[model samples]
Target: MKATFGIKERLKSKKEIELLFSEGKSIAKYPIRLIYREATTEKNFTIQTAVSVSKRNFKKAPDRNRIKRLLRESYRKNKYLVSKNTTHHFTFMFLYTGNKMPDSIIVESKIKEILQKFISKEIEKQ
Candidate 1:
């Protein structure tokens, strides 16, 4: 698989987003929280994902956008960890919960850790 974040990998449907929040299970690895559930739709990809940064943490739009960008970049690069060896399709929402701005390296490492945790947990369930 190519190391690319395509549009198809984005979670855009309002109903799906609602379902994800309402029915998903969450795993938090500090700074980042992941909410995920098995996809209801028969999509092609292994996962579709969205990202969020709390307005309460950063009141400015630029600050939130920057953090979101870092989250996306990290996930885009490391998402293969979740996709590989998984037969299930999932929808994921990644939320930033830290009060202060974090470096991209911190976000990336945390994301890698969380994704690995997610994969391990899912494997055990199978």
Candidate 2:
């Protein structure tokens, strides 16, 4: 199993997401929108994750950070599974579209479930 998500595991910039969206395909399961594009590189993938809590929900940075942290941690732990299923590498973005910040445990569970579905989708794609 891989040990790290590394620099490439991150969905660091907007251009990456834009490129994927313009050319790549997407799958959404509410609160989680997954945009993925095949990459030419081997055993290399990039992921950008986000959670949405508008001014109406979280009025503070800390509140927002708390949610983002959970999402990231959850992804970091389970990313290797997604990483291994690639015949071709992929760049993926997990967007949080929920209206408010739920419990961290719930968010973590949701992230894992979402990732599992993503792996399942990849199998179907094959």
Candidate 3:
């Protein structure tokens, strides 16, 4: 609700990440992909999330870090869409699948689209 991305909201545990990947469902919008699963967390947070950029696409650490930063920023701004609508807790991973360097506008717009799609899919599942 504070629009802050804090430590408790980060997906960091090795076990949790493994479980999410093993049982998660994924949605993709061109250069970005979302992998998510319903999960109960030890913390009070409703959603725990992580972002990744493929090392293969960006050979330089700075490039990958930059893209990851963009992904996190986009998600942070739009996280309320999922938080406000969902009754269940979830773990999420956003993967960057594109090779080119991205602009913030493009990343933000795509993140909105991707989250909309995810929300729609969740509705359909209900």
Backbone Cα, N, C clashes tallied per candidate: 0, 2, 0
Name the regions of candidate 1 deviating beyond 4 angstroms.
none
lDDT of 2: 0.67
> 1-126, model 1: which lDDT tens digit per residue?
888988999999999999999999999999899999999778978899999999988999999999999999999999889888698999999999999989999999999999999999998999
Off by over 4 Å in 3: none
Deviation of model 2 at 41, angstroms: 5.4
Best by lDDT: 1
Q: Clashing residue pairs in candidate 2, if any?
A: 11-47, 11-48
lDDT of each: 0.94, 0.67, 0.91
Question: Model 1 lDDT vs. the true structure?
Answer: 0.94
**What TM-score does each of the candidates earn?**
0.97, 0.75, 0.95
Best-to-worst lDDT order: 1, 3, 2
Where does candidate 3 have its weakest 10-residue lDDT segment? 37-46
lDDT of 3 by residue, 1-126 (tens): 878899989999899899988999999988999999889655589899999988899999999999999999999999999888888888999999999999999999999998999899889889
TM-score of 1: 0.97
